[model samples]
Target: MDVSVFEVIGPIMIGPSSSHTAGAAKLARIAKDIVNASFNRVTFGLHGSFAMTYKGHGTDRALVAGVLGLYEDDEAIADSFELAKQQGLEYEFYEINLENVHENTVKITFLLEDGSNYYVIGSSIGGGQIIITNMNGFQTEFTAQYSTIMMKHYDRYGIVSEVSAILANSHINIATMRLNRNARGEEAFCIIDTDDIVPYDVKECIEQLDGVIQVQVINVND
Candidate 1:
């Protein structure tokens, strides 16, 4: 039997624990990407394995650096908090129980400029694979391994189906998806995971779609 791609490379990463460290970083990065304004403050809640060993395993630092837009392979991960401070970002950390969630999971809440706020819950499944379990109180999930992910811009008269249709036309197969909208419904975002590797051409095509203001590729080596 042919091994699924996820099965082959899902457990290895440059960290003490693939789920706690790498997963935490990916989750923080996703949250950073979705916020429209500059992030001024961040709060992280750790659960399971993340809560148990985040400090020792460098999970906390990894997460902090990721939210600050640093890549997984960045050498500065160890000094993420200091770096964030230098960049005028502030953060706090805490431990919480998620009630029946994975051991290596965390919740992050961010306060951005203009008084906007966002929250995210995510888990690191061993290897380098991570799943975003929730965003802004919405039950959703996404894999960050995709080469291209379309993040919908918040606006009135937005139709999510149109975004899906555009991907279908491009012959892209969506592996997973997660959506979040503000309580007022004035702001919204969708994180899409696709099977097709994203190239510049494909990214440009998606950016042209209505309501899509940005197409970002989050990867370790990008």
Candidate 2:
């Protein structure tokens, strides 16, 4: 028997552990990307190893800096909390038992300007990989490896079907999919996982959709 490349190689990520370091960073970065307000405050619910050895391993600061849109390799990670304060981002930290969830896991909630808020539950899988288990109130997952991933804001119309049509026409296969929305239901994040890497032109096409706000490629290599 043989394993698929993705199964063996997993994702290309910056790392200490896919589950502890890189995944944590990616989760933070995505949380920042989805929120509509400037991040004024944040809370982290750390569990297991994340609580036990976060500081020694740089997990704590990595997550905080990530939510600030900093990458895993950024040298400022160890000092991100202070940087956050200097940048007007106030944050709190808490320790919790996630109740049989993955050991290296976190539940992050943010308070943004304009009185809006968002929360994300995610796990760091191992090599530098992460899976977003929930966002806001919606249960969802995304592997940041896709050359191109399409995340659309919520719309009442047939958005999924329409987007599917475009991908199908281009001969792309949907590898995995997850959907999430904020508590207010005013917005949603539709994450499309695909077998084929996203081509530059295809990204441009998705960005042109009526309800789409931003179409970005998570450069896994970077």
Candidate 3:
């Protein structure tokens, strides 16, 4: 197996624990980007090790900062609470026990301004790396370090190929793709990682495709 340089040397980030700080920030930021909307309030459900040392280790501040779109290495991570308060982004945290999950897992729930809400569940797997395990209620695993597009659509033949064609037409190469469905012929979700940044127009075009329900283009690299 070939290990990348980031895993070998760790990431450029603030705070002490890579799991609690960098990973937490990335997880939250990705969740925010996934929704691609603004939320007036957020809630963090800390599980396992995160619950034990979050406040002492600055996980609280880091998580909040990420929701506000601050970088992992941003010094503003230290002042996230104050900045959030000033920006009218209310937040809260609580501890909860979950089964068969990584010790650094967190559930971030965002309550959007229009009374809509969504949640993202992920784990900080150390060395500043993270895996978003679930979105809304779909079981999935994706890293937020790349350009990705996730869409919800009807479970039908040709949907995956349809999305692939669109990406290709936009001059984007697919790195990886994962698909999950609630049941056969039911609603499905697809995550596509790309070699290039996904344009917002590309996302709009995907949304117009037949059988596609919703589309979210996340380009955390930018």
lDDT of each: 0.73, 0.73, 0.90
TM-score between model 3 and native: 0.94
Worst 10 residues of 3 by lDDT: 29-38
TM-score of every prediction relative to native: 0.73, 0.73, 0.94
Worst 10 residues of 1 by lDDT: 213-222
- Pick the winner on TM-score between candidates 1 and 3: 3
The candidate scoring highest on lDDT is: 3
Error of 3 at 211 (Å): 1.0
Q: What lDDT tens digits, residue by residue, belong to model 1 across residues 142-206?
A: 66667447465665464567767777888878777767777554667667777776556666776
Q: Give per-residue lDDT, candidate 3, residue 176.
A: 90
lDDT accuracy of residue 138 in candidate 3: 92
Tens digits of lDDT, candidate 2, 71-176: 7767676678898888888887789887756788888988877788778788787666666677676666665666447475755477777778888988888877
